[model samples]
Target: MQKVFFISDHHFGHKNIIDFESRPFKEVDEMTTEMIAKWNSVVGENDKVFHLGDFSFLNKEKTKAIVDKLNGYKILILGNHDRGRSRSWWLDVGFNEVSEYPIIYNNFFFLSHEPMYMNKHMPFVNVHGHIHGQKYEGKNYFNVCVEHWDYTPLTFEQIRDSVVVSEEQ
Candidate 1:
């Protein structure tokens, strides 16, 4: 069956990311290789992956190359750094869809690159990524940054089971 996955803050080809996130890699190349492997391990060709941004620091050609190797029908939610390219550019690079802003999924999960404000009174759970090692202090926020997930994409079931939906809280 085709599954839905979520991940973000890949920072592919960003040399500083190794040290910034304390990633267990000697260099960007190693990081890229291993991350791609991990991503492919859990995601199938038919799976859908929602990447929440800060995808890469490499040039267009290089970025596209990496994206091409990833599994899944990719969709990107533009993070802060992803603003360097246009939505069409991201599409040309391999993403099936690119969103400039947050997207609502299943009428309850709010997906974004950066965490949005959510409270007990709200009707949505914010699933986001941007802060590498830090996360919001609430059940309504779910962080999918690679740092927190062993550099692997998370399935929709995993996310739903971990978060308390607004109505349930």
Candidate 2:
């Protein structure tokens, strides 16, 4: 059986991540290379990988290049960076789907770029990214939380372990 994984907010071409965030790479090209390599290491041709949003800093070409080189079929949930482009642009690039927010995966809520605000109506876990693990304090919300961005696919058990909850859950 193939495994499904979720990740978000790589911001590949964003200088802020390279300068402020102090990412290991000095440029987006280097970053993309490492990210693609890392993702391909864990994900296989049969696996499914979900990328939330803000994948790159307007460098769709480079981003597409990196994605095309990776293993697994990549699905994209469009983020703020995807603005100003046609809806079909993502599919034309390589993404299977381009959604706005709150996509569903195995009854779980999946979001990228930013953490989707949750209410009582949803009992599903929200696996999200877009931060250095600073924005959110808990391991999970709704049900589970994924808060890292190294282009790696995580196991369900890893996500479940990071979940945090309130009394309502």
Candidate 3:
């Protein structure tokens, strides 16, 4: 069966990301290669992936090249850096869908590129990215940034299990 996954802040082709995130790679190429390997390892071609944003910082050709190599039916929730690019550009680069705002998935999971603050009384869990290595204090918010997730895509089951475990604590 096909699987669903979440990931963000890839920052592909961005050399500064290595220093910014303290990523283990020594160079952009190393980071890109490793991230691609990690992603393909966990994500099959038939799977669906929600890329929360900041997907890349490369030119159109280079960005499309990277996207084409990844495994998954990719959906992009546009992040801050994704601005200035047209929705059609993202789609042409291999995203199955491009969204500019938070979207509710499965009726309970709220997906966005940045964390949306909702009160404890809110009904949905905020699944977001953009904070990189930082922690989100909200009980119902889950960060899916590549920095936090070891450059791998997270499955819906994994996120749900984490929430369940947190609730039981």
- lDDT for model 3, please: 0.93
The TM-scores, one per candidate, come to: 0.96, 0.79, 0.98
Write out the backbone clash pairs for model 1. none
TM-score of model number 3: 0.98
Candidate 3 Cα deviation (angstroms), residue 166: 0.3
Candidate number achieving the greatest lDDT relative to the actual structure: 1
For candidate 3, write residues 1-169 as lDDT tens digits.
Answer: 9999999999999999899889999999999999999999999999999999999889889899999999999999999999889899999888889998888999999999988987999988999999999978866899999999889999999999998888788
Residue-wise lDDT of candidate 2 within 80-127, one digit each (tens)? 766656658777777776776567666765555566666557676666
Best by TM-score: 3
Off by over 4 Å in 1: 164-169
Q: List clashing residue pairs in candidate 3.
A: none
Instruction: Kindly give the number of clashing pairs for every candidate.
Output: 0, 6, 0
**Model 1 Cα lDDT, one tens digit per residue, 74-107:** 9999999999889999999889999999999989
